[model samples]
Target: MSSTTTEVLQRKPRNVAVNTNPEHGLHLVESDVPEPGPKDCLVHVRATGICGSDVHFWKHGKIGDMIVVGENGLGHESAGIVIKTGSEVTRFKPDVVFFSTPPYDGTLRRYHVHPEAWLHALPDRLSYEEGSLLEPLSVALAGIDRSNLRLGSALVICGAGPIGLVTLLAAHAAGAAPIVITDMDENRLQVAKKLLPRVRTVKVAREDAAKDLGTRIIETLGTEAELVLECTGVESSIQAGIYATRFGGSVFVIGVGKDFQNIPFMHLSSKEIDLRFQYRYHDTYPKAINLVNEGLIDLKPLVTHRYKLDDGVDAFATASTPGARAIKVQILDD
Candidate 1:
């Protein structure tokens, strides 16, 4: 083979993954960095956000059936720069920072791989720190989309967590007239208020969401919201969503709570309201990036704590803390 060809091929990456077994917490091992196949691009990791799912794996060694076996990487939300691309790659080139997540190797290290379709160019105004946040922001956009949110629609979001706060921002940006947020954590609630100055707060536990809070929110908002975005997957929040939405409005389920909840199908069935289930996100990153680019959405506040890649453990712990009160915990790579 020619020396030039050899040099090009040698630059291709193999993948090294962070593995967690059922018996161990976090174990680091090295493997070949991954090389992109056609339609895929290789990203040099810049920032990876610690998510609740990662913490679940670290503590319990599992999240549902997504067990971390030999050589499995655990992370799904992050942003990074593209370093290599396949022959078929379009819309991006080497060194372009973009958002990568889910069903793709996470941006937790120096390198990760994802399809071109899964990546979105970070806005020029968005830093890697702000860019990593688009993943959660897209989720909030998905919640807004699922709720069929329209202009002047009133919204009630349960849980002032990151997802909830993002939903609040998305709903507000989408021109939903009135939005209310609820959470048990006063600190997180305070952050939510700062992040979204317009969002009304309710200090109610998950279990009491339906019973005590539903009617009160309706009275406060002057009408039952036409849309209820359930960012807290807690059972009672689901109940509140089913009961609190305007008789013929929609409820968007944005959070992943315990396996399933005992939903009030009677009220839902009788009310003829749509109970929409939102998945991670599809084709919404561009809009999310635009939202950030235009200043319609500000993500910097969501990042309450920062760390380097090596501090991943502390990052996950802070993320998992019930009341660390941080909305987003991010890890940066030097």
Candidate 2:
């Protein structure tokens, strides 16, 4: 190995953000820099977007059956530079910016070892922050692909969170018209309006009936939505999406929620609305990267807040706080 590679390999005491337990929440812990396996690449993680799933794990201790056993690192949406590649690695070299997801310990750390196959090289034009956002953008693209969104197809996005907002951008770029986004928080709705000035925004209340909210969504669109991307994962929002979708329309569930949710099954059946669930993303990174590189979609506006790796706890707090109005909270190594 070269002297530079040896030096990077010897870097010590990496800072990692971990969810110790429900009581402790997220905090930084020092760990020895990990060495890459034969097919792994050691990455100098530059940016990691705090995902909603990470927050859910921190707040609730788990999502469904995936319990946080012991100390669990809590980030997945990440991009970084490959400082050292394993012996078998040939796809990437040192100093290449790439987006990656480490299967076990998360990427909310300065140094991460990721499998070579899992890494996708990011273009020079995109910042590490923008590259970190590809995971969520991939999700949005997957939802759009599943929706089969056509030009001028009326659509309803059930939540104005990061995923919902990215979906909004993807759908807009795909030529979906009269897109309406709903959120209980007026601040988030305002952000959505700012992201897409022509899009309609709706302020919803949890106490209000789902059917009523659905009616309001239809009214805002002036017609039943051909596609409803349910990003909230809330039972009420799912019900509202079901009610708002026209006959034969699709309701794609992209949000992760409780193990079981009560829904208006009969209504969904009667309306013949296709209820599809999104479990992360599948083979969308290339398309997502191309979209951003081609200027068809922009992910920069979604990063409303940024924090250094040492302030990981504060970053999670800002993301979890309702009043913070942070669309995407990113933790940076620099």
Cα RMSDs of all predictions?
Answer: 4.0, 2.3
lDDT of each: 0.72, 0.85
TM-score for each predicted model, relative to the true structure:
0.86, 0.94
The whole-model C-alpha lDDT of candidate 1 against the native structure comes to 0.72
TM-score of 2: 0.94
Error of 2 at 180 (Å): 0.6
Per-candidate total of colliding backbone pairs? 7, 0
- Backbone clash pairs for candidate 1 read 13-33, 14-32, 14-33, 14-34, 15-32, 15-33, 15-34
Residue-wise C-alpha lDDT for candidate 2, range 1-334, written one tens digit per residue? 5687577566555546554464645678888777789999888888989888888877777777677766777788888888877899998753322332223567778888888988889888988988899989989998888778899999999999999999999999999998999999998899888889999998998698999999999999999999999998999999899999999999999998778889889888888989999876678888998999999998999999999988889899999998898999998886
Scanning candidate 2 in windows of ten residues, the lowest lDDT window is 94-103
